[model samples]
Target: MCHAHFEDKYLCRNNRISNIAVPTLKMRSPLTPPSTTSLQQLNLGHGPSPSSLTATMQEAALPSTSETNVHLNLGEKTTVKKAKSRVFLTNTEKYLQDKLVAASIKLSKMKNRFKKLSVNVKAAKQIASNPAVCDILENCTSTRKLLISMQCQEDHKKEKERRFTLQEKIASLSIFKQSPKGYRFLRFFLFCLLSKH
Candidate 1:
């Protein structure tokens, strides 16, 4: 009876010690084995073999269903595989198919419209830069081709006018330096030369 009591007390102490140690063991190394050495540490490379690693990885990977079967029993005659059953569509299914097709066509048209809209936006931006082009665009509102042609003509006219003005300024500056006194003196000298001639 005394030995039995002592054994129970010893077992209780051991249980208490294990409960305390388990928490510390988990805290110290979460992945480490409770025993001193693991299988990986005991191995020469301190890791699993490549073949085993591949095998374990394959085992861990999700299993896929196999549709093809090659094996056949010798006693049983080889039977030809049955063809797939024909799919019969309900009225609702047919309606849904039609709706989906129409939706896809509408989506394609919308995409084309969006592309055209983007092109138009780019064209509008190009035209908006020049007030002459804008005025021409506003005035020539008959047809797109006519409006574009008129705007182009107006742009060319403005460009020619700008070039002519610049050339005139350059020509005047070339005849005399751009100081008021110098310009007046040059005009007076020209006037005296013209009078003597």
Candidate 2:
């Protein structure tokens, strides 16, 4: 849709060099109905009761699979209660699982190798489901521990360097007042100075 603005040219990001990034946009997607009012317009402090809000949400939500139940006996009507499934993975583990899968994909496709894009459980499952992707991602889990160990090592090295640089920069860094906007040029990147020389 932004073709008019871009003039059919791809988006470009500049660092030391220019990199063209082609963005993927899903078209003809269903749009949600307009909201009755904005959050700022409502009295959030005492707008609605928690139970009432929950009930409203449930009413608005689509019917779930659990709501549909099969009954063998037509003569007698009965209700069956289903127990909630237990969650085995914690929030952090679930997060890392997704990241792990994405990373593996991007790494696979590097020079003479598949550039692994992601390393996560969901991505891994998707890749495993595809015979073609599986052919490419044969050693996903076998290298998981290795990838994690390498990540930890890199983090440790960066942290040690940062601390050492910060100690050295403290004596040299001079404090100066900033602009009228109250933002100034950062003397150090996250308190660790990088030498230009």
Candidate 3:
């Protein structure tokens, strides 16, 4: 019913198919609409126009063709990409240079973080020392707090060991002395775990 809705019927009650001057239509398939040239030849006075019938049946709307999808098929159309070579640390001196540079950057960041945390912890200790909070302080020894204290101690121990390791590495690098400037890099970076007085 939906397919035939577009095509209107206009057969006279007395007229028959053999009596008409128009030739019989050739149907290629039951589903496909008749060819546009054949449909254009038809002139039913009251039916919808041939242009309207062809417009609806033209290939479904498409964004682009296969040729448009390919961008770099031609030499003139294609652009080269930025290329880089992989660098393996084969030279000991080149590897050492990169290692020293990275270690210096990491050392400065570690020192700053350690200093800030120490200041906060010192302020917290002073705050806890207030005489008015003695009753609350006496009752503050919970299992959770004990576990937290143990974790803090372990973290502090690890921090001290890491600082010693850094010092050892810097000391070991003393073998590579510069001919012009001497080992100023070692003196500049070798940090000590100084205790707060």
Candidate 4:
């Protein structure tokens, strides 16, 4: 494994154990062979060293103590007791102000949405009240076009008829006014009609 991977695993392993030691080998030059002098100095039972023998014997004779375990446990516990901190520790006044601002914004958005919905409802009511407005509100392009064209044609015919009748009445009045005999006749006819009434 890579150095980072090895350390991550080692740290995780150390977190679980109360007291453990993992020995790692130090890197040495590849060209150098094992040095007998170094091994001999450490007194690895190869050559007789009286002082090293006594030191090794003394360590083996002693009992395992609770002091080492206590020290190791304390060292590992520091990371757990490092005073838990909160991410957001705002004062009461500041928190209340933030909540009020948020509520106001939410209220504004809801009011806007309600206004839009009311406007749509009002428009739908208006469309429903009048048949022509309802017909105009149809989504189909061809149907609306056809209805508008027919209405226009009917209006044009009515306008033409009204104009024709108005023109006929005007022509008859002009002719009657041009001749004195026709004017006298019209006066006699009006007098008779008024007398009957």
User: Where does candidate 3 have its weakest 10-residue lDDT segment?
Assistant: 1-10
Candidate 1 at 148: error in angstroms?
7.4
Evaluate all candidate structures by whole-model CA lDDT and list the values in order.
0.52, 0.47, 0.50, 0.56
lDDT of 3 by residue, 86-192 (tens): 44566897989889999999999999999999998998788778876666656765533443343444444544453334433343344233321333442334322
Q: Using lDDT as the measure, name the better of candidate 3 and candidate 4.
A: 4
Tens-digit per-residue lDDT, 1-197, candidate 1? 22332333344443432222222221333474456455555674577777888998997784543412223342233343222345678999999999999999999999999999799789978868989977766776343433244344344343334222343345335545556565557435432111111
Return the candidate ranking by TM-score, descending.
Answer: 1, 3, 4, 2
List candidate 3 segments past 4 Å from native.
Answer: 1-90, 140-197
lDDT ranking, best first:
4, 1, 3, 2
List TM-scores for all candidates, in order: 0.28, 0.14, 0.26, 0.22
Best by lDDT: 4
Cand. 1 TM to true fold: 0.28
The digit string of per-residue lDDT tens for model 2 on 18-135 reads 2453434544566887665654356455588678889989977856555543234422343222223444798999999999998887666563332333444558577569998656
Measured on C-alpha atoms, candidate 4 has an lDDT of 0.56
Minimal lDDT window, size 10, model 1: 188-197
- Better candidate number, 1 or 4, judged by lDDT: 4
Worst 10 residues of 4 by lDDT: 188-197
Candidate 1 residue pairs that clash: none
Better of 2 and 4 by TM-score: 4
